[model samples]
Target: MKYLAAYLLLTAGGKANPTDADIKSLLSSVGVEAEDERVSALVASLKEKNIDEVIAEGKEKLASVPTGGAAAAGGAAAGGAAGAEEAKEEAKEEEKEESDEDMGFGLFD
Candidate 1:
């Protein structure tokens, strides 16, 4: 399921569609121990659907999922805040290090 989700996102983000063999490999890689019939049926269903329409529908569905929407926004916000803090800390550390170096505090003392 995770692989499927990732594949969908990747495809939606302009990556190429998975080939039949690629789909089979993905299923096997994900340890889906279903019969070949089940896998074939899934593939058939996917094939019957319009790729662009399916991707649009998935985006809409994801937008409606409270957890999914919230998690995405939360992750972005958290990442932005963390990145800003890290940059600030790095700048401060560099300034402190530069000041210490300017004082000639070294092994030669």
Candidate 2:
């Protein structure tokens, strides 16, 4: 991830295609030690690709992904019975507390 960030920083700074040295230098400038293997891998993976196009493609792919509660809440809200069960449990707990208080037992006693 650090390697990727350095690469993007160089690209944003007008280095259309950042080299391994450039990535390592940029990372070192901010007190980060760059791993040679990871830097090389990142450069190789992004060789000959346009960053802007890649980001645009990523955005398009993400746009189709579900990012709302509907999909996540489907299973939890199934049968619509959780609310009733939760209410019953809450009532039982309240009754237990009231009975305990009615016993007139104090911690100091």
Candidate 3:
């Protein structure tokens, strides 16, 4: 993930294609040790690919992912129901407390 982040940073900075050494240098600058095997593999895999095209493909793939707005609405409904129940319980408790009071039978009465 770190390697990929560094590669993307370099690519975003107009490197177009960042070498393994470039990735290593960036990681090392942040006191991270780069794994040569992973770096080489990453370099090999992306060597023939255009960064822009890859990002576009990734975006297209991500477009089909569900945001679950319906699930969120259901959660909100559940939360609201819970809140209403709490309010009712509080109102009941208040009523009980009032009934336990003097109930208009004061000293002057």
User: lDDT value for candidate 2?
Assistant: 0.88
Clashing pairs in 3: none
Candidate No. with top lDDT: 3
Write one digit per residue (lDDT tens) for candidate 1, span 10-102.
467665665445556665676854455655555566764667798799899988768677787887788997877888999999978767576
lDDT of 3 by residue, 6-107 (tens): 999999988988999999999999999999999999999899799889889989999988789878888778899787788899999998876735666644
- Candidate 3: residue 23 Cα off by (Å): 0.6
Q: TM-score of the candidate numbered 3?
A: 0.59
Worst 10 residues of 2 by lDDT: 71-80
In candidate 1 the C-alpha lDDT for residue 63 amounts to: 80
| Per-prediction CA RMSD (Å) | 9.8, 4.7, 9.1
- State each model's CA lDDT, in order: 0.66, 0.88, 0.89
How do the predictions measure up, each by TM-score?
0.33, 0.72, 0.59
Residue 3 C-alpha lDDT in model 1: 44
- Please give the ranking of all candidate structures by lDDT, highest first, separated by commas: 3, 2, 1
Candidate achieving the largest TM-score: 2
